[model samples]
Target: MKKLSVSILGTGFVGLCSAVCFAHRGIKVIASTHNEEKANLINQGIAPFYEVELEEILKEVVNRNDGNFKCLVGRKQAILDTDISMIIVGTPMGEDKRIDLTLMEKAAKEIGEVLRMKENYHLTVVRSTVIPGTTRNLVGDTIQKISGKELGKDFGLCMQPEFLAEGRSIKDTFYPDRIVIGEFDKKSGDILQELYESFYGDHLKKAPILRINLESAELVKYGNNCLLATKISYANEFANLAELVPGVDVVQVMKGVGLDYRICERFLGAGVGFGGSCFPKDINAIKAFAQSKGYDPRLLNAVLAINDDQAIHIVDLAENTLNNLSNKKIALLGLAFKPGTDDMRQAPSIRIINELKRRNASNIIGYDPKAKESAREVLGNKIQYANNIEELLKDADCAIITTEWDEFKILKPSKFIRLMKNPFVIDGRRIFSFEEFDKELTFRAIGRVALK
Candidate 1:
């Protein structure tokens, strides 16, 4: 049997991870990018974004391929010559809350032009988060119109949505709960399934591959993200309730809720709502899609509203605690949204800093191991960037942990408490306990009892 050729467009998070995952399973990957600089980064075994295991995986694939199936910049001859091309380009949200499919549209046109220059039957799979009917409308129809080829006869079409977390992208790709494929027909489904033949079988024996219509697959991506967003909002709502009630902690409430079989305890922590590439974008897309279909989407709108409030709750606490915040040096422990990756797209840190700046809060200092550069870009001139934890907390009036980077978890309280001018720490992520801190420092944690 001849090996199937695969090309992944867009060198961003989704594209890079997908390329390496396929290559790890022995598929020939032509990871395509428009810029020569990004392509050079990939060729040199460096991932464009900060993912935990992506560098290792990318380097392994490139070394194994011996430069044959490596990252290629531009619409190179090799990418156009490949048998299968997957579109993982970004589809950003426009001002109107609709998905901006311009990137995907341009990539599809290029792929179609490549198809026009070829005779073999080619299959194009879209893995980006797009609105329903995008593959059929934006990609499939565009390719058909451009290449002058009949759909499902001269060529094939499918949508395979990617489910990857920012930091845990590598593991999530290969070991996903299940792989869903929306194909035009069973033949198209089978051919696409063959690409993942190596990864599936043993662990997911029963229903490793799920077959659905193209729109269903697109809907599945949105549905999953919306549900996750709901979980965060639900937890935050409970945390607000807990705050109002005396002696009730949302941490205990979540612990009780998680003990139930249905809840299972993920995204239940009530600190500053979710911020990253997936949750915000996906939830907004769901709202836009729902509104377009004539639905009110009130529930999703509330979810976002609650999240916005959640982001500011910490700053509110800080302001309420200190009467005047000007000229007071405040320390922020984490910057990335949930850590592990250097992506700070919608990080709650941005919200907290902006709010603080508005109220003329003291000097805001931030320190994060991985997300300093990205955070710096978002927080330019608004705050000072600290080199280390000690520097961040030096003579600080209060400390807040927005992102739960693991390194912050193990820091000795004795060390943190000693450096502060006034020992008031807001455990926004519920990272520390009373046992860690002395009686002098007042600890204010989310959904937990405060100790002075």
Candidate 2:
């Protein structure tokens, strides 16, 4: 069997992951990017961002196969050279809170221009998280206008949304729960299905392949994220209620709630609300998109409202515990939105730190194993960056664990007791056991009663 060739546009998380995963499966992959530096680095077997096991797989694929994996500076040649082209460009949030499709449109225009020069049939898939009607209207119209090609006749178009999380992208790509292909026509859908089967069919025995319309495919991405975001917010709400009632533990309550067959325990863990690349943006975009279509997304709006308030609530816990935040040396244990990845976009730590600053905290020190560099980009000297956890907690009045990194979980309670002047700990992620701490130490956690 002749191996399928694929071109991935935009060398960000999704694109690069897809390229390497496909190449690992013995398919020829052309990773297309506008950034020459990024392309050069990938070509040399270097990954631009930190993803678990991504660099090793990328290096293995690049070295094992002679020309199976390649990174190029532009999309034109890559489009002409490959059998399939996947658009994975960044769709940043606009000022109005809707998804800004500027990068997606630019990639579409470029793909259309390149398609004009090629004669063979090719499949163009939108793998980015876009609003519904975009694949059929904006992307299809732009490509058809420039290439003079008709969808389902001269070429193929499909919406294959990616579901890989930031930290576990490689694992998710290699073993996805399912594969969704939303096509303009039967032929396009069939082609994409065959390609995916070639790579993942044997590995994912039980994972279903869903074939649906373009609009449904686009909406599925938003639907999946919104539901997860709702779950997190719901858990937080329950935690708040549990805190008021005596002898109630949110973790134990949630554990029993999750044991029910209907609701499995996945995103049920309560913490400072979710904040990464997807959940917050997708919820806001869908809300804005729904409003534009003359429908009010009340549930989604409430979810956003709850999340925004949750971040502030963490700061309030710290302030109330200390009685005054002014000139207090506080320590933030985690900076990333979650564990495993360095991405800090919309991280709850950002809001919590900013709130502490507003309350006149004298010195806010932060430390994260992987996110320090990325956090520095957003924080920019506003707070002190600690070389290690000890440095962050030393001489601090209060300590908050924002992200649940493994290193933070193994810390001895004695460290916090001996290092801090006041020895107060606020556990945002419920990382420590309340009973483990000594009576002299002050301990507080979200969804649990404060212990002294």
Best by lDDT: 2
Superposition error at 157 for model 2 (Å)? 0.5
Per-residue lDDT for 1-452 in model 2, tens only?
Answer: 67669999988989999999999888889999989999988988999988888899989988886788999999988999999999999887888889999999999899899889889888999999999999999998899999998878888999998999988999999889999999999999988888988998676577799999999999999999999999899889888898888667788888999999899888888778899988988888989999999999999988888888777888888888898888799999999999889999999999888888888886899999999999999999889999998789888999999999999999877899889888988888988886785344787778887533
lDDT of 1 by residue, 320-370 (tens): 787678978889999988788988888888888888888898599999999
Q: Which regions of candidate 1 deviate over 4 angstroms?
A: 65-68, 76-78, 199-201, 434-440, 449-452
TM-score of 1: 0.96
Per-model TM-score, in order, reads 0.96, 0.98
Stretches > 4 Å off in candidate 2: 438-440
For each candidate, the alpha-carbon lDDT, in order, equals 0.83, 0.89
After superposition on all C-alphas, the RMSD of every candidate to the true structure, in Å, is 1.7, 1.2
User: Each model's number of backbone clashes?
Assistant: 0, 0
